[model samples]
Target: MRPDFAASSNPDSITDSSTWEAELNLGFTQRGDKTVLVRREHRGPLTVQRPFYPEGEVCHVYLLHPPGGVVAGDHLTIVATVENDAQALITTPAAGKFYRSGGGEAQQTVNLKVAENASLEWLPQETIVYEGAQLNSSMNIDLAEHGRFIGWEILALGRPAAGEGFDSGAATLNWRISRIGRLVYMERLRLDAEAFQARWGLFGHSACGTLFVYPASSLHLAAVQELIGDEANRGVTLIEGLLICRGLDSRADLLKGFFERVWGLVRGDIVGKEVCAPRIWAT
Candidate 1:
């Protein structure tokens, strides 16, 4: 007689039923020459309220991922608002990891808005994609007149340790930046494991990342070009004061280190040291 497979259910199967969801909002306001803000929301499954204060001119925010992370059909949203003349920096406590989707898809959306003459630095930790996971992410930024903004995204396709490198699954990323309801920068990246892994495609290196700055001046453009020269075979584009840097590498740590170096250069030149780094990164 054949074994009755339906009679036995594994413990792992029972635990996979629970899904994860996280909704967070961070608000910043200017106080004299300093920017003060409070993080009022929950982190993943943990229901705790945390507040952050700026050490100098910069304020930091940190995000912690749930224990198991997003399952199929999970949705996560993050919204940030910077008041007039305020400056703030946002970062995640650690890199976000997306596990394989059991049956459905997972999505994440980020929205950022800056008031007139305000500045915002979006420096998320990083994102790692696991095998068989489907992820869709979008970033939208609205800038006020004379507002300064800088941000970066570093994505690793798969677990290099296990020799898994985006061999399957799908990912789509979109970015849009606007000024006073007028579009300034728009870009979209779509990739499939097999298609993108080809020699000439995106995943040939296993990891890719982008760094962008808005309202680039002539001097800034020259300086950025000089800084990126022969660093990693990067490409720089300028559109209406926006400077964009696109880079690809075979290692995840290399991409992260590159962002740190480039961010330091750009921040020192454009935003100065008075601004605070994201708090999550400090820990």
Candidate 2:
């Protein structure tokens, strides 16, 4: 299991009576050509549904947050490990909500580790940030030689369709990926409500998203490009063998659909088999 997140700069953050800190750790292993969940530990409201095998060899798990949403000073951490030759795909049943903060920030940290010849897919639903909310989110991925990973993140600044925009809030995001003990990708995004609404910045867009694929080989670059044609408010790039796809939109549904298509394509190629959406996604 991964270590807990470092203590917050404000020592009182977790000590507040209203604050809630949750943690969950999971490990997967291969059992005679079938991926199975071998370990799981949790504290607080984080948990996972029973493992399902939709593709025979791949295990599908759905992470659950029973509280359904996060409030001020809430801290959530998740860590997952996949052993050699095992494959696992994890997703959420619904969008994660970050409610308005009362001068305190909510934090979420995730770490994933994959051993040699292993494959892992981290595909959670979108995250919704309410006005006046302060959110800090980070993801760290470590992969051994020949390991593979695919993941995506979507964030909505506010409820745009409902006429609620991010008039006041702060958002910080960090993503890091390392392969065989060498860092290959790192990105950080910080947004202040005022500047984020500027034309030169987010341009009043209420939602932004990114899809990341690691270890994409030259042989698949052309195919990847063909799948992602030129589109407004969207771009695709390859950095240090990581394929990054980014987009900005007013609605989360648009970005969600876009990411799903790319996920299907990439998974098919990497796994050498067609994949279907997990049954839980429809519920």
Candidate 3:
């Protein structure tokens, strides 16, 4: 069955349309002493600002969705490839918003490719999904031998500060991580109204997140645990060198902050450098 998006003569144009279909493709390659964005392709509202090198040589980019929010019948895609020996970090200017939908599902897909001896960091801010919204999101990462990656996806289920809870609709998330063509970790989670209010589920928490770090050691897990030990709803574990961290909170900012702290603790081990906070984050 086909998705119900209206036919458009121009694939990149959203003129007079109620729904949007957008995609962005980014490629980074090492040149001389620096990593550079060599490829950037986009359609519709999805695009990126010029690459920033606040730390020098390491390319940092901010994704932009000009419409500011996604609603029913919208589809978005983001793909990034880091060539051999290159390093890049990708983030968004602010939290993404998936507004309430009347019926159809809004979809977002992300694909990340890290080549041999390369490093890529995916650290977008939290996504805010409003009440009555239907969202389906997926992220897949493929890494070659000697490649490294650290990434996280934080989600805010509803506008907690606005007294809105995700009482209706659903969001499904899927993640796949593979190395050298071998699939290692795969997961799928579906959240609906029942799960939102259930003690076994979120138990009224409005925000949740998962952070993944490749090439991690048991020591890294211990260090992260030391940061999360005081929080009852935060946890970390190591599986086949992949360190997975999870957290839940009533506010999205809190959950995002916790992940940032965890990232700061392990970034040096993962990337051989300490965290250089993105300047756009403070603005």
Q: Pick the candidate with the highest TM-score.
A: 3
Candidate 3 or 2, higher TM-score: 3
TM-score of 2: 0.91
**lDDT by residue for model 2 over 47-108, one digit each (tens)?**
99999988898999999988667777889999999999999999999888777777888999
lDDT, each prediction? 0.72, 0.83, 0.89
Please report the candidate that would top lDDT against the real structure: 3
Candidate 1 global CA lDDT score: 0.72
Residue 270 lDDT (model 2): 64
Ranking by lDDT: 3, 2, 1
State TM-scores per candidate. Answer: 0.86, 0.91, 0.93
**Could you tell me the TM-score of candidate 3?**
0.93
Candidate 3: stretches off by over 4 Å: 1-17
Give lDDT tens digits, candidate 3, residues 53-153: 99988999999987777777889999999999999999999888777777789999999999998999999988888788889999999999889999999
lDDT (Cα) of model 2:
0.83
How close to the true structure is residue 4 of candidate 3, measured as C-alpha lDDT? 24
> What's model 3's lDDT at 1?
24
> Could you tell me which residue pairs clash in candidate 2?
none
Question: Candidate 3: what lDDT?
Answer: 0.89
Cα displacement (Å) at residue 159, model 1: 0.7
